[model samples]
Target: MAINNDVLSIILGGGQGTRLYPLTESRSKPAVPIAGKYRLVDIPISNCINSDIKRMYVLTQFNSASLNRHIKNTYHFSFFSSAFVDVLAAEQTMQSKSWFQGTADAVRQSMHHFLRHDFEYALILSGDQLYQMDYKLMLKEHIKHGAEISIATIPVNAKEATSFGILKADKENIITSFIEKPDAKLLPDWTSEVSEEMKNEGRNYLASMGIYIFNRQLLIDLMSNPDTNDFGKEIIPNAIHDHKTLSYQFEGYWTDIGNIDSFFEANLGLTDSIPKFNLYDREQRIYTRARMLPTSKVSGTTLDKAVIAEGCIIHAAKIETSVIGIRSRIGKETTVINTYMMGCDKYESLDEINKNKTSILMGIGERCFIKNCIIDKNCRIGDDVRINGGKHLEDKETDQYVIKEGIVVIKKNAVIPKGYVI
Candidate 1:
């Protein structure tokens, strides 16, 4: 089918992002760096672009400056074309003076702006997720089923199902019942008819992917009510019986980057021999900002399963199962394992580097040993610093870093003194 021009995408930027703290301390959740160079927001936007859905609106509230700047710098189209990506920050308006209360309320507050556009459907997506999907296929299924609302569902095991909103679909794939994060005891009754492969893997319950396609009119009618604040918790549950909701089952590499542990694992997972979320797919390309940066220069580094971005100057002793971001500078004899080092924003001048010879400098320092950690952007690690994250360490939060679930997250622009140990 031809590209669907009748749909407008609305990417929801999550609130606070306290779970992914330290990383989200300065920037919004969507603006957090992911998979070496790309930001988290790039995933859904790239998916939309690949599906030929150009126009998109990103709704955000806290720390939206970086997200706004990233979107503006990355997504650009011809002036003659209708393609554009805009950021809508929460504002006090005549209709509503409060901030976005929940997922549904965020769209409701911005409905006026959406109404000005000419579209038949609204594709709502979460900003903090890692997955690639052709939204066109879901749109096609929505139309074929004559669905008022269509939710992308994935078969998840009972352990994982309790964390998401589960849906039970009828023989026609029409959603009949909905429960928001059901109890473990309710798993048997909530199991849906998934494929044989999913069944064999003990993934029988259908969990909502938090991706939805709502008919424009139906969305408008639903938004008129101020009571329904969240889609999964309130709207979906109430509308399942009344509306013709279809569950578009998707079996792919989808993971919700809700917390620090998940985010850390997701980045490290990319260093796998064959990652489930393929970034090398020629057809399903992941788009990001086009920077005019030089190629990375590696010398004497024994790299193993490392994904390094452009403009890096690496001389580390060894880097295994790590994602080194753009403009990173790793000094000699440093060992980074199972870590994500979000590189610097800009290169430090030679003069500046020389002046800081006796002080902490940007990127990993010499003789440092960092393992199972996430070094945020522009971090300076002095020589001989050691951070070994594991279950032995208890969860704690410092001014410069945070240790959650045994994963150390160095805050953005933090400076670790020389010879420091954790």
Candidate 2:
């Protein structure tokens, strides 16, 4: 593989993912299970690997141990080579600094790290998006156009456009106007630039993918600008006129798995009759840390549009449109639907009373029934327990399980007693 010494990939994986609720209460969004097989962090890391960009760093905070372990196991570089991947955490470099304040601040905090490396461009991306793109092509375009900053923008529906950072690009593809999230009327008329079919195909309004290719020195200079401490809210909008920012029009499978609906939708998208996003391309395989376990086994169970990862045992359970994480056990007569079960990973390094036990490892309780809920890592549920549509009862103040938006959240390393209904 040829090395692109001028580029360094920086992935932002630290967001709290509050909107994803039950799924993110204990772990960061990047570590959240996706399609029952891979973590959200796998998306960007897989993209970088497939794009042939090896030098990468993931910036993370807020329950990052699982995320860090996933990255360490999934992304391994040869010791004989100069190219490598690293995960960066918020650490006190000096007595003055404490933790990353924002995305811009996260990058700003790593100024010293990149300062030692000689890279001409920095490829910044989000860890919580499901998309497949050839970033090498985008980088080539960035260098060819001599762009100070390049943003990955895709057309999204106007009705759903307010959820993203909307932009207005000129005829030459230069970004002229930018808004984090605009009202419907305030959005630019992308119809003229795109086709009606595109709009119908979930494409019309240009939305930022939260992916950027920044001229290294220019980004450093921009970060040094005390007036700006945020990217989408401040620096990006501020760079509209002063910088040669270009919008790279991307039309492909792209979904921001930021909220619960989007997260659930993205997971369900994987089981589409003809999935929009393909992670099984042999030529451009999406790589993740292998669990080194046997493939999942189902005994007299029925699975419909579900994703079951390795080392899982489904015993006569009915699973539909859900994602089951690693090392989980689904008992007979149990039903799981539209839910995300995050299994216990030894990599999480949480203290557990059960050793190498599937139920104890991922925090799932034996014989418990989960439905339309998100069970966080390392939760122990006792036999014959009912999740009740994954709904949580708010009346119990001292109880550990909290429900948000009709989704029940079982925190990491939690223990639910036997026969108890949550």
Which candidate ranks first by lDDT, i.e. highest?
1
Misplaced by over 4 Å in model 2 are 1-3, 188-192, 199-202, 346-369, 390-398
Q: At residue 105, what lDDT does model 2 achieve?
A: 85
Window of ten residues with lowest summed lDDT in model 1: 1-10
Model 1 clash pairs? none
Q: What is the lDDT of residue 393 in candidate 2?
A: 48
119-235: candidate 1 lDDT, tens digit per residue: 999999999999989899999999998999999999999999889999999889999998888999988999888899999999999999999999999999999999999998999
For model 2, which pairs clash?
A: 344-361, 344-362, 362-378, 363-378, 363-379, 365-381
- Give per-residue CA lDDT, model 2, range 75-115, as digits (tens): 77788866777878888876325667778888888878878
TM-score of each: 0.98, 0.88
Q: Please, what is the whole-model Cα lDDT of each candidate in the order they appear?
A: 0.94, 0.75
Model 1, global lDDT:
0.94
